[model samples]
Target chain A: MNANSKTENRALASTVLELDVNNHAGVMSHVVGMFSRRAYNVEGIVCMPVGYEKNGLKSSGETSSEISRIWLLVNEDARLEQMIKQIEKLEDVLSLRRHGAEHEVFERLEEFFH
Target chain B: MAANSISNQKEMFMTSKRSEILTGAQIVVRLLERQGVRLLSGIPGGAILPIYDALSQSTQIHHVLARHEQGAGFIAQGIARASGEVAVCMASSGPGATNLLTAIADAKLDSIPLVAITGQVPKSMIGTDAFQEVDTYGLTIPITKHNFLVGSAEELLEVIPHAFRLAASGRPGPVLVDIPKDVQNQSIEVSDWPAPGASDPAPAPDAVLISRAAAMINGAARPILYLGGGVVHSGASGSAVALAEKAGLPSVMTLMALGAMPVDHPLSLGMLGMHGARCTNLALDECDLLIAVGARFDDRATGKVAAFCSQAKIIHIDIDPSELDKIKTAHVGIAGDVKAVLGQLVPQVEAILRKPWLARVADLKATHPLRMPGIDDPRMPYGLIRAVADCLDDEATISTDVGQHQMWVAQAYPLRRPRQWLTSGGLGTMGFGLPAAIGAALAEPQRTVVCFTGDGSILMNVQEFATAAEEVANVKVVLMNNASLGLVFQQQTMFYGERIFASKFRGMPDFIKVAEGFGWQTLDLDNAGDPSSALRAALSLPGPVLIHASIDRHEQVLPMVAPGAANKDMIGG
Candidate 1:
């Protein structure tokens, strides 16, 4: 059985959905609102624009990597699989990757903060 | 200082070819008219004055001045729900934008297509928290389908179309656009307006999954087709019935899908879940296969998720890919449009008459008939709903507020067509009735619109009564005055050892007087010697009318499965 299979296990584990979306004003709302509307909980979220932008040197249309990377930490239930599929369908989302509980992006952040 | 940022952003973002030079407010007005927006509802303030000034010059759009921002949003929802088209509402900064939150959340929960436009403080003042300034984009982020904070006039041109497209497209919901005041004042050149993108057609169903679902249907001895709101949104009621009839399968409707299948149909299991018929819940428990079509297994519908349809080998089909296998892992998951998928699957499966299974279903239904308390007495809420249902045509749309009255309507109202029944199912929002009814009435001017509201729910958005009267909307407010938050009171009674504190309203306002104050024709059901005559007279009134119904506080929504209990473990008769 695949590790993601619901049949083999019902054990709850946290999963992260990493998404790259077009950097824009409304994109994050679409990502966050879908979860809230469905009553699904997001344990942690980290998002930031890719490439250099602190100096305001690049125009919005000119930058090739005008993309924002979003990491959503959620319980790896059957619902997460479906949520990932929906997130992929969003027009602004360019690509997505699902990481199992072993992924330590949020944990690493915690360690850095400490 | 706030105005400088808008100018700075405008200079940086003038990439589009300049064809015409006009103020940002004028562009907004022109864009709305070009997009075929005939009606809008809002209350203008200092930040939005320029837009309103431009709006006043236009003859194409009629703006309704709502008493509250929430009323405006719900009115837009009503229009969208009734018309199956995008609707718009507007508000200014701070409290005005905050007031619209409840309605926006309601729209999000029920998947209503709405676009809310809010005016913000000048861009520099956004973070500074100037007078009447609030971060509308931040506040509404969790409640909207998408939200835009327009930085410049050029951005406003792009954001408006995107807002409409996002609001109307795929599993539709509310979207918001927050415009800085200076952005609306500054002149910008625009070549042409981008048209809102049309909704993309649902992807074709997988051939392999279709066959798998067909095989499951053919093999199962007892199968049930569970339908929800997505079926209605996709206009797939005919296909839903076709599949059910072809396979000789019983069907169950959720609160949002009450009218997807006609209640009088022979194989219909009226509704399933907390307030569901006992037979329907039992049928679900016994079902060998649960073919969930456009139906998310919501907690209210599923009771305890693990025990719900435990025996069923599920075949889930939905337009939204996310809905499939979300709650219950399906044996065969087909991610496609309900209509197209049903069209593909119905022909592949052979028709079978499951005589024994259907007979058992009939027996269960007979054994646990839906009993009403004093149903013959018009004084009861149940009787009032029955009386109203009798008077209204099938074409009439019924919008309801959340509470005991909403549940009573779900149980007793024989909704005949999809889109005719509008209720806040997912969000369960109170105070949604009057404003939604106004939108519904305006959307379908020829058809009658009725709002079923409770004493507690009406108080949440009582300000909407003025809007209903001012618009002269073809709506009737059937206020079931139980003098308490009936559902909360019921829950407290059952689970909290009858400890009712905040739920009761000892000195509720006279609904008749309130309706009269709002310029509506009023009818008091309690005082009328012949209530049927009074009801008929109220229905015949030319303008907005309020039928004040006096009901007992003891009346409860029956057949309620306790929290986290199995569907079969219902408490009331």
Candidate 2:
């Protein structure tokens, strides 16, 4: 396919989600469970604890190792809006930002999987 | 010099209020006391013995030992549903935690506030499959509002109070806190105490959206108020009724929202759903504006979502934002407390008589009202509920197990106040009634609590009868002995080409003997010439009494919208 067609195909096939969540042992289970329970498939996931800055300063004290960022790639469907709303309802999910399929986060990691 | 002296004195005072060493179990009990939990229910086991030991030392809190872990969970649900406060229940590891899952899930679906504390295997043996070990936190992740797996005793100080807060705050649900055996035994020094967790104030309704909703209501010639469980949960029934009356909107309630608007109200259409009155559902079919408050469009409530109120423009108000468009998109969706939204929206809307529309509704009501067959005969299902209801005033709390009896009570019983009626609406749990009724009675000792249960439902939680007898709870269990799962039988007979399977029971236990064996006062209405008087006498002298009455096995909950069918396609009434 041509470059523009390839991008269009990808957009039609999937959407990427960026999530900021609490870094805890059960956090990943909770995020995945929400999908698994609904029978919604999550094709790719990349999660890692990131440097969480609070008020533009490095968070200290007990919350030093608090936040983690998660990237999810999944098929776009009618239920996606409802799924996003549900994910936002989770207590551990700090924030969620939706991105189109053209987002580079998942595309860049495709080479490693290949 | 004076400021320096004052600072020195403050430091001295801080040092004097030093941390005292206490085990995690002691901290849990102390925290529950601080949270103003006077009564809790649980069953002690190997893992939870330490907490029970600590509980025994607590003079402020009283623990009711339930016959089963599920009973304990439902008991807590009962207290929460009755009092609108976050109630607590505890259990040990493995099976105990698993058993409590259903009640927790029930609370979650109904949005009742509950804190469930379960004892976990020691942290070291957690993954080793030690005796009575379970992954409680993982298991409860989907069912609970939030859950905590405490790694350390110090975490208990924060987790306990936080669990209560999470359970009570926005769209309340059950929160589980799993404490490992080691954590419960571990000693920790705790000086500072956290404040008791209470419900956080709901966010304010959007003025623009509220105004839009007001405009829609004002402009529509035909409008209907759709009330849900959220109305009862948020204590917004009064405000909802006010909005309905002021706008002259005929109101229909979901099963959970039955008591929100008085059944006797002139503008009330009673309940609208699967087994709702024909007129109520027909009115929704005809409305131009559907104002849904605090209610998600549950499938049972909204039969065939696409077809439900197809002509109406919906203005949905709920505390949970996700629920707004989850099923059906709303014209104006307001994610705020229903009580608060109505408080503001009521005044902004124009007060109109809508005479022609109301007259149309009245004609529908006159033509297709709820048919209570054998309503005056005490031997029949509807009559039994009415007879039971006649014996007690509005102060009496009515609960029901999931079955034909539950629907009969929902259809016929005069539930005139909010929280006056409690049934397993969302979960449709059969075993919920007995234990929940005991809990409600225990919570509010003055009010007489009655549980209308069918034979099939009462058998699911028959063990709780012993707990009720032991506690001497003012619970009246009116057993409708139909010798079968009535609702299941009805569905099979109607939808499955008249083929009935395992719905009927071949052998039935002598329930009166069973109740008497459990130390309960037994009343057999089967032979009573004056059943009403017998019911009154039994209800008056209540300390866990079982009043058994035989119902026809073939009786069905009518006006049922066949599964996945539109509400307009109701079968019978």
Best by lDDT: 2
What DockQ would candidate 1 receive versus the native complex? 0.30
Interface RMSD of 1: 3.6
- List TM-score per model, in order: 0.89, 0.96
The 10 consecutive residues of candidate 1 chain A with the worst lDDT sum are A52-61
lDDT by residue (tens digit), candidate 2, A1-114: 799998787667888999998877888999999889989899999998786562221222345467789999999888999999999999888889999888999889889988
In candidate 2, residue B94 scores what lDDT?
96
lDDT of 2 by residue, B476-524 (tens): 9999999999999999999998899999999999999999999999999
lDDT of each structure?
A: 0.86, 0.92
DockQ score of each predicted structure, in the order shown: 0.30, 0.49
List the pairs of residues colliding in candidate 2: B559-B572
Q: TM-score (0 to 1) for chain A, all models?
A: 0.74, 0.79
Across all models, the iRMS values in order are: 3.6, 3.6
Instruction: Please name the candidate that would achieve the greatest TM-score relative to the true structure.
Output: 2
Model 1 CA deviation exceeding 4 Å by range: A1-18, A24-65, A69-91, A99-114, B1-18
